[model samples]
Target: MELKEYMNFVFPGLILKPSLYYQWDTRIHFELAKGLYQFKSEIDELNDEYFNRVYDQTTTLFNEIFSHNDELFLVTNVYKHKGDIKRNKKIKVYNHYINNKNIRFQLKEETLPYMFDDDDADEYYTSQFSLKCQKQDIRYPVLLKAICNQDFPPLRPRFNNRGISNYPDLFFINIKKNIIFYIYDDRGCEVIASDIEAIRPIYEKYNEWIDEYCREDTEQLFK
Candidate 1:
């Protein structure tokens, strides 16, 4: 089915904010299966049983859809949280039988937002602001790198001063078609399919439909 048709059926009756205001950072929360918890505490604190369970289940889910021919990657943001904590939020990416599992755990400094400044505080603040503004645009390259790395952590963190957060958990790239599928967690497993051509029609149609059905304020947010 066409993307719009799918959205109409899936998103209709459901209340979803427009793509702009929709917080990409929340994807990890939505994707975690029921009863499985991803701790917000330090990674070192994560128990091996919980980690293995999550990993095994996640990998199983991914492997079901993606294969070797299809490139899979994780996408997420690196956020410097309060208390000087650096956390990596995981998201899941799968396409055509190739599951790029736990790709967010493997991200490096170069793949995340970076800042150039003498003042450490200023750099962190600036990077955070920039990341919020340009996250959608920067998402592609990070996902590409994740796929290329075979979903493994790079040697050493990419940089020393900056910390990362809200990293993407999953990405699927159809190399032959040059299409990128960003599968995020929202309410359920929400998939955002973006190809210059494939998604434009859906966006246009969604805009048109919103114009007919949504309030002006709501429309403004969604558009």
Candidate 2:
């Protein structure tokens, strides 16, 4: 089958939200700040435990699926502003999983304009009375929440939320086709099969309930 046809057949009506941090700015920045303050420090601790468990499981799963040697790295992106000099954004710190020496090529990039606000001056001033001007664009925390709340097993998910927020959970990477497949936990009900074609049938069979679960749209689904 053609690649397009295969993707459509396998992933019909999939509404992929381009990595969360793309074009991130003031609006997303504030939301992330609110989420962090509301969620608290404990969230970071929980996310650490979550990553450890997921990484261990992913290693085992990869080994079972493929016999050849392969490397896995946790990747995340951080955005920095031109001025207001802080060497690294806060979001980069939360992605501690990649700190290890063993993992290779763990980081990737996507860019967004710094401190650019879409709203007119009057509208922005009215909406955010406190700050003279919005600066910086980081989006890690909110993206982490979205990944964690999803159903996929603790596999390290990618993030585009450049270093504007402190999401302690998400990670990102590019993979080789020959070395094991990519298994994505898309929220709670769906699992996306990437690269490895042989297991698509199995994934589809196991995750069949996701369609019904997604359709129900119950509040409980998120929890």
Residue 50, candidate 1: how far off, in angstroms? 3.3
For 78-170, candidate 1 gives per-residue lDDT tens digits of 335334443432222222112233433333332233322334533342111101111222234333334323322431111222343234333
- Estimate, for each residue in 96-201, the C-alpha lDDT of model 2 and write its tens digit: 3223333222233333333224453222111000101101111323433445434333334544343333222322321232121222332221223343354443
Q: What is residue 144's positional error in candidate 1, in angstroms?
A: 15
Q: Count the backbone clashes (under 3 Å) in each candidate.
A: 24, 15
Please name the candidate that would achieve the greatest lDDT relative to the true structure.
1
Best-performing candidate as measured by TM-score: 2
Q: Distance (Å) between predicted and true CA of 69, model 1?
A: 1.8
Which ranges of candidate 1 are over 4 A from the true structure?
1-33, 36-49, 72-172, 175-190, 194-223
lDDT of 1 at 15: 20
Alpha carbon RMSD to native, model 1 = 14.0
